[model samples]
Target: MANFHVYAAGTGSDVQHPTIRRIGVSDVLDALRLGFEDFWDKPSHYVFLGLIYPIVGVVLITWTSGGNALQLIYPLMTGFALLGPIAAIGLYEISRRRELNLDTSWWHALEVRNSPAMPAIVVVGIMLMALFVVWIVTAHTLYARVYDDAVPLSIGAFVSDVLTTQRGWTLIILGNLIGLLFALIALSTTVVAFPLLLDRDIGAYAAIETSARAIMANPVPMLFWGLIVAVALLIGSLPLLVGLAIVLPVLGHATWHLYRKVIEPAPAPVPVKAARSRKRSN
Candidate 1:
């Protein structure tokens, strides 16, 4: 375990963050397992995932409606993932509630509203949204450069073009490379920050620093963890995004557990003894 710093609430003092337990690959899996348990045990709390499905439904409708925007759909689909940390705030609260054996409610997922961390959380959300917007713009620019002004008329045409042409292949390859960079930046900054902010009464800077430190300290396992998240999200986005109803909640809950594994709470301050007075002889 390593010591880190966090602000002591009300006392206005900084203290060592205790419980910075060493994490490993097993911990990631264990967190996922626990997350699964949370979702499976109290499935109703995750219904918001279902509520989110309608948004995907609209995207699906748009896709099939025109079938011409295939080039843009990939970016849109993947970009949907960029906002996941903020979107899953409810699930984090749910897991927190379950951890304390409090009554977890679908409505209570919005407990984030009452939290002192709301401002910081809002800032994180804004940061993610900005990245998402940038990614969309960059992706469109790349696609435009590759295709010139011609747009695909259907899904079949887009796939055929993307698969058989040099421009298509290059765009796919380059687009993903750029997206990878964006994903890494997002992951390193946030993998633990969101949970940390929610779990503690600290500023966003400390939360972000803790998250980055965790990544730097455990690169290998963290890389694997990132891979797991990317793959899980990609798979979840399939099937009309309905799979997300299950995948998102599990990952959301798992993230809280992972944060617990990666970062420890600050140790309690040791009280100092007052010096003995010379009045003993008197």
Candidate 2:
């Protein structure tokens, strides 16, 4: 069974906050470079996970197009940012293993299930999922308020309305402004939390606090990092979202490197008997 004790204080070890580092734009760039290297080293390892996004993208687009919920399609695509951290957990594991020179085969990505922090990871993932749901509901409400229960009849009509009308401009401006808030929240909280949890046994609370502290300590660099992520994802989303096949894994691996940059390495464990022997000799 997965260990749930990571959430309980002093369950196995004392819960202490990990040290947060103040990284700069250089560090962020280095992380991305290293991430790309990781992806290049074994592109085949990430193929399955990468293809999943395109498939899901196609399905969601079809669902919205068929159901006359065109307003929701954009929201759904943007909402992927909020859930991206959770989806990339497996990528983090693969990167972690490679960092240690361990086996990083495709199946090894699933090895995270045996991690001590799995339960904590699950909790944080659920939090992100809940946030996604809220964004969708809020988007729906925004559309309803502006359009008043009138669903766009077709893709061409929806595009024309969204592009040519005053209400369309209002929807565009307000939706983007609101979407920025949600994206910021996701970035602030999860920028390093998932990878940190996978790397160490820190509880979810400590992981989140440390991630927030990392951002607070280096807001400019972190914000720049967030911008890089948004732009990369946006580009990946073009061409039928197929580009994400390469973009997601690269970003995912890079995120692991980013966490390494932001968090200090865990301290080495002291030898218990050596302490007692030294005390007695003294």
Per-candidate TM-score against the hidden true structure: 0.85, 0.95
Could you report the Cα RMSD, in angstroms, for every candidate shown? 5.4, 1.9
| Model 2 lDDT at residue 87 | 77
Error of 1 at 30 (Å): 0.5
lDDT score at residue 98, model 1, on the 0-100 scale? 91
lDDT of 2 by residue, 1-282 (tens): 335665633466556788888789999999999999999999987868888777887898899889889999999998976888887889999999899999989888888898888888888899899999999999999999999969788888988999999999999999999999999888888889899988887888777778888889999999999999999989999988988888899999999999999899999887999888989999
Q: lDDT: which candidate is best? A: 2
Badly placed stretches (over 4 Å) of model 1 are 1-19, 53-57, 60-68, 268-282
Write one digit per residue (lDDT tens) for candidate 1, span 87-200.
788889889989999988778887788887676677777888999999989998998888895777877878888899998899989999999999988888889878888877
- Model 2, position 163: C-alpha lDDT score: 96
Whole-model lDDT values for every prediction: 0.79, 0.88
Choose the strongest candidate by TM-score: 2
